[model samples]
Target: MLKIGITGGIGAGKSIVCRLFALLGVPVYDADTRAKWVMHHDKALKQELTEAFGPEAYTEAGELNRIYLASVAFHDPQKLELLNSLVHPHVGNDFTKWVEANQQAPYVLKEAALLFESGSWEQLDEIIVVAAPLDIRIKRTLQRDPHRTRHDVEAIIAKQLEEEEKIARAQHIIYNDDQQLLIPQVLQLHKLLLSKI
Candidate 1:
């Protein structure tokens, strides 16, 4: 199966584009959501987290203490890298199983906000970047996240690969800047992928 990666900076409408692909019967693995699940359920991952961050990583009820984990890792780059090192490998393993289960698919999409940053793009056959103007992206994010200010959105964008960089690296691009109609572009890509199959 062709493993396609769909990535974009925060608020670039990656999820919406993935949803369009999902409608066409393509299996979509949402990396962020699955990563959270892996962090909470993978035994070795939980053990590594406890070792790195102490037992406070999980609560008495065996649930991941997100607040505690974020407090320890969010502000410190090294701590955050440690956390990702432990978590991403498990997520990658889970994605491998997910792909096996959907082996008959013409293509499977792994949608991630940090596909390039996490170095997961190397595992995929092609990458589709969903792009929108920075201002438009910020506006969309603000509308979606009511509590986040423009500065908060900007900070997130600053951490992600620049829009130009993602576009330059992508094998396919989908524009979600509101001026372009998204479905036709998605359909075109969908047809092309099917033809490749």
Candidate 2:
């Protein structure tokens, strides 16, 4: 089984690309969603969070306190790194188990916004980067998140690896700009991956 990492900057339409892959019967593990789940259910991770961020890391009902954690970590780079350090390992372990369970799959996608930043890309067999123009990405993000301003979106884009960098490192690239038809690009990649398998 091939472990493929799908990544792009915020608003680059990575989710849309991943959904297309899922439609083709590909096993897609969304790292962000799984990270949240692991943070809530993994006992060791919960203890680490509590120790790092104090008891407010989770509520009495054993739910992660996102607001509290964000407030404590977001403003401090060191705190944010510590948080990622704690969570990434658990997510990696979870991904390993998920891959084991899907050993029959030809390829599996692990979609994450920070695949490279978290160093998870090192574990994948290949990487597919979804790319789009900055203006288009900002517009898409604003449309998807009504509460976020253009500045907020731009800030996020700034924090991510540059589009040129991601494209240079990726084994495949799917353009999501309005000018390109996404389905065909995805289909072509799907066929190519199938051939490889």
Per-candidate Cα lDDT values, in order, are 0.93, 0.93
lDDT for residue 13 in candidate 2, whole number 0-100: 95
Q: In candidate 2, which residue pairs clash?
A: none
Supply the global lDDT for candidate 2: 0.93
Model 2 TM: 0.97
Per-residue lDDT of 55 in model 1: 93
User: What lDDT would candidate 1 get against the real structure?
Assistant: 0.93
RMSD of 2: 0.9
Model 1: per-residue Cα lDDT over 22-82, one tens digit each: 9999999999999989988899999999999999999998899999998898778899899
Write down the TM-score for model 1: 0.97
